[model samples]
Target chain A: MIQFYDLAGARDDQRLSPYCWRTRLALEHKGLSYDAIAWRFTEKDLIAFTGQGACPVIVDNGKAVHDSWAIMEYLEATYPAHPFFDSPQAKAHALFIKHWTEQVLHVGLTKQVVLDVHDMLADRDKPHFRSTREQRLGMTLEAFSADRDAVLPAFRAALSPLRTTLQKIPFVSGERPSYADYIVFGGFQWARVSSERDVLEPSDPIYAWRESMLGLFGGLPAKTPARGAILAK
Target chain B: MIQFYDLAGARDDQRLSPYCWRTRLALEHKGLSYDAIAWRFTEKDLIAFTGQGACPVIVDNGKAVHDSWAIMEYLEATYPAHPFFDSPQAKAHALFIKHWTEQVLHVGLTKQVVLDVHDMLADRDKPHFRSTREQRLGMTLEAFSADRDAVLPAFRAALSPLRTTLQKIPFVSGERPSYADYIVFGGFQWARVSSERDVLEPSDPIYAWRESMLGLFGGLPAKTPARGAILAK
Candidate 1:
């Protein structure tokens, strides 16, 4: 059994960390049974065994793996059933998608949901979250996202590439849901779990994809507690 | 031999279209011997048989194929010698990269090189090119790209995702070059072939990758003529 440490918010069930969601979905995709343990922002000591403070750390048969990307690689290499990547080139192509999600989708979503994330953090994690995030963003979370409403159109427009892509295929990895789908869905899942605001229009193809992703693995993602009824079927 | 209708500028050797560059590179990558015929923008009647006015059209064994993406598919299906895609999922993943290049990289490069492209086009192509482009951009090509210097930073910033990916791997498709690399390199090749301005700094990992791409296939890409000595080996 794999022990997965997922980041929690105010409630134990509120697993809002996008990277952790990627790992969770990947584990399920690989048909691996794992125990998901709730972790918090300030609980660096809890995951220190993995030599990193990040969530999405997995301990499999006493061997620890940290970082979502590394964990996915570890799972694929160790298990190798129901492969996450088709080949070396496929994995490499998926890496570009991973970078796109991180650099583009995650950056845009952070502005919309940073305030919500701060509000949903556990009391002990609040100070650490705000301080670290503020330092990186170079402003208070409120100020950083102050123009989110005005910038909403730009954020939506930035999704044109992804929108065009989903228009042609059912999933990011095509025909079947793969790690590429999970890589992108994790960003939306983060926003869905932490905020009530709707980032994607119902008309968007991504919205339909998200609905399918939520219903995967016996409604695994849909079962998570969220801020609102965002994941309702 | 494949009859490749490559886009040409004022000079017959100046093939500046990014889409054509993608097909050209794909042909070279597939080890296909092709007769490169210069085709101007207004030479629609020449390729009317393909039911399109695209310059990246190919005539192979009496079959006509147009559009860079579609042409790539035709080549891959017809000649499966050097597999362009490792698997179905790999091809699907490459499709996302294709969208990124079209939506993001090409958009930025167009703004930077539209004027250069206008100046390089044959006299017959100038009016058609400007009218269509201006209508789509909603401004004169010069007016739209007037703030090229001011917006250069943002254009470079948008490439952070590609830069990060290349930093980790030797090529866009991992250890070896694939259609993903050609898809992106096509955009850069557009700017490189039409303009004198250097978009990439020598320090960027993308610069190194571009150098490697130019050196591929016995310097096939390096052999193209340009307005400036941008491709100097």
Candidate 2:
């Protein structure tokens, strides 16, 4: 069994890190199971043995694998029978999707949800999270996202590529979902779990794709507890 | 032999439409011979047989295939020997790349070089081109691109996904250049052929990839005549 050190917010069930979601999806893709040990930002000491502060680290049979991309590659290489990468070209394209999601989508999404995520952190972890995030953002959480509504048009416009692609196919990887789909879904799942604000339009093809993604692997992502969820709050 | 209706500017040698470039590259990738016809912007009547006003309309053995993507699919299906799309997943991912290039990259890139492209137009076609483009842009070309230098940083910043992807691999399709590479190279090639200004910094990884792309097919793109070329003018 793999021992996955997953990142969690204030509530143990508030698993909001996009990287962790990617790993979890990868594990499920490979039909692997692991104990998702709920870990927080300040609990860096818990994963210090891995020689890294960040996580989605999976200690598989005592071999710890960190970094979402590494973990994805590790799973694909280790479980060759469950081939996620069909070809070198396919893997290379998937790598583009990964970077696009992280470097582009995550950059824009962070601005919209950093404050919401900070608020969801454990009370003790707030100060550490706030100081680091605020400094990195160069403003208070509220101020950073204050203009999100104004910037919404630009943000949606930036999604032209993803929107255009979804308009053609049901998923990034075509008829069926693949690791490439999971790679992109990570950012959206993180945003979904962390914020109530909708990033996608209900009528969008992407929205339909997200519904299909949420329904994947027996509703794994959909089942996760949405942070600051208003359904019953 | 394929009869590719290539978009040209003032000089017949000045081929600058990105979509046409994609088709030309695709023809080369398939090891097909083509007579690239220089079709100016005002010469829409020349391609009326295809029922479209687009260059890149390939008349392959009397069958006119309009649109770059439709041409790509036609070539792939017709000449199955040179298989760039190994699977449906591969094709789907490539489609995403195409959309990304069209929607995001082209939008930003046009702002950078639309005026230059206008400058490169045939004297007879200039009026028609300017009226259509200015209306589409909602401003005169000069006014539209007046602040291009000031917006350079943001334009460069918008290339986050492409930059991040190239930093990881030599090409968008990994070890070898594929249709996906050509899809992206199209926009840059258009800019290169139309403008003297370099869109990429020499130090950027994308600049290195562009060099690799330029080196492909015996320096086909690199050897093209840069329009209104001031370096030697």
Candidate 3:
């Protein structure tokens, strides 16, 4: 079994890291079972073996791999029998979704739940997470999320590309869910597992896509405890 | 030969429509030759054969097709022999790039060249073109572009996703040029053909990718009389 280091909130069951979700969904998609090891932001020493300070690191037979993208690529290269091994072109195009989540979607979503993430962090993990986020955002967590409602419009607007894409096809990876779907889905999953706010309306195309995504792989994503809609609240 | 009704400005040789460029590149990608008929926005009657008022109508052997995305799909479906028939996953992911170009890149790039697009219009097409754009934008072209220089920073920042994606993969389609590249290239191509103001700096990764795209298809995009750095300003 793959020994995976997953990011955890205050509650051990609250797996809220978007990157970790990407890695989790990918492992499920590739039909690989793993022992999930819960790690918090304050526990950098836990994953020091990986030579990195991040969750979603997997140690498969003592071989450590970090970063969600690198982990997914590693899985695809290792397990070619499943749908993850599509093509270079698919990999290339999915890179756009990965970057979109990393650069755009995740940034917007983070504002909606910056404090919620703080609330869910282990007591020891709280201080460092808050100060680091404050430094990066140039404001306190309370001030940053003070006008979260104002951030909602732009957040929804940011999903326009994904919305428009879903209008034509059911999934980002096309007809069936692939790593592309998991990459973008990571944003919603992060928002869901981390916050109480409804990030998406039931009417949106993306919301519908998220519903279908939740049902995939025997409802693994849906079964998780999230503050938002597991299936469109 | 495929008869393509391409959008033109003051010069019949100038093909400035982003959608038309996607169709043109897709045609070239599939190794198909076509006679590009110069068309203007006012010449809605010209594409009446396709039951649309769009300039990207491609009539092949008396069968007409309109819309750049549809045309690329039609090309891939019809021309199955070439490198175009990759996989459904590639096509699915390409749709994201297409929508990203349409929804984000096109809108931002348009702000930079809205006035220039009017400036290059055929005399007969100018009034309606300016009026329609003004109606959509709720501002005169002059007012809209008065501070276009100010819009450049935000426009370039909006490209962070693309910049990060290109930093990893050479093309949006991955290892080689695909319809995804054409979708994005069309945006810059539209900007280049429409305006004298430079949009991207030479140091940008996108600039290098654009340079590579300019070299694609035997320098077809480079040979075109673009106002920007087709050959580095």
Candidate 4:
């Protein structure tokens, strides 16, 4: 059996982390059945027990896999019928995109979205959002905002390569969805589900691709009750 | 023919980066012949031609592979013999160690070493060090130092898991050397090469394991360059 660990009380519109979303979508795409566990950010003993302190960890047949990319690789290797990487060249391309998505695109998106989680969350969750942010980042709101703003330009510049790369390929690796698609999809879907509409409008092909992904996996049920909240934490 | 694009005079000691070493070592391990193009870090145009502003970008059979992990993956896929990932379970273990090496270990080693490059390279070449660092990080020495100090804790914490993981398995993925070994080798080797005595202390099984790797590959001409300066651009 496959087990997914996520955040509880997470809302569809307010669930904003791309990393968590990628695993959930992959499970759906592979048509894998799994149990879900919503974990609190501050209460990380469960994660530590597995020798990691991060979420979106997947456990399959008693083996625990942490890190989204590793988890995806595990799934692909274990279940070859629903292949995540088709060809050798395609696999290389997918790995490139996966690294680019995590190291570059994710950094930019996080800076843009993380600062406004309180405003993005439901009215009742504002205090919870603020507290969670403080706990995770160990910084006051003012400091966090400043730090976020400072990194925006670097983030923007880092994104230019990706934008150019994506323009050439239909998907991150072209045509069918590869691991790269799932990686980018996690972040883009988070922004689409959580942030206001206009946030992604300025970007053209990226926005279009994101909408297509949403339509593909929109039917899957929320993996955890707190996916949105877990992402926020 | 395989072609490697590397910086000509950079001091990326194992402590500073093991990614470069991984690629270099892989080339020797596979017993592949290739032309090595040593690049200066400040030479953005050269790196940009490869579509990334990073060292250790390799072009194999006309295909470009950037990022150390991706480059290694490309090598494993392209040259299946002397395989980097042997089995599904081994691949999973390799991916896990790769993630930890890149995300956790590399981050820390970069902080401890790159931040002090100016001081370390003062006798050798100041202008080159300054220019190279500026190009790689896009920041002045003062700014880079601050950034390095900030990320130190994360890097330090990265070691504990490695220590525990290494205790169980001789290599990161057990008996045979895989991509994980190469990746971790990059970071640990950097630390060792930069300073005989430094942050990543050569103690216990970690040091013993590294010595074993060096001894294992030490005989090959391709593995052991005449001088470190030849490869440091």
- Candidate 2, residues A32-61, lDDT tens digits: the string is 878999998889999898898998999988
Instruction: Please tell me how candidate 4 rates in CAPRI terms.
Output: incorrect
Model 1 chain A weakest lDDT span, ten residues long: A224-233
Question: How does residue B14 of candidate 4 score in lDDT?
Answer: 18
**Fraction of true A-B contacts recovered by candidate 2:** 0.70
lDDT of 2 by residue, B1-233 (tens): 78899998877888899999999999999999999999987788999998878778998888999988999999999999888777777788888888888887898898899988888889988899899989998999999999989888888987878888888888899888898999999999999999988889999888889889988899998888765364467
Interface RMSD, per-candidate values to 1 decimal: 0.8, 1.3, 1.3, 10.7
Candidate with top DockQ is: 1
Error of 1 at B17 (Å): 0.8
Q: Model 4: per-residue lDDT, tens digit, A45-120?
A: 7877579777788889889998777778788888776776554434433443455566556656655666554555
Which 10-residue window of candidate 3 chain B scores lowest in summed lDDT? Answer: B224-233
Give the range where candidate 2 chain B is weakest over 10 consecutive residues by summed lDDT: B224-233
Assess each prediction's global lDDT (C-alpha) against the native.
0.90, 0.86, 0.86, 0.60
Model 4 Cα displacement at A63 (Å)? 16
Q: State the local distance difference test value for candidate 3.
A: 0.86
Cα RMSD to native, each candidate?
1.9, 1.5, 2.4, 9.3
Please give the lDDT score at residue B152 for candidate 2.
Answer: 84
Indicate the docking level reached by candidate 1.
high
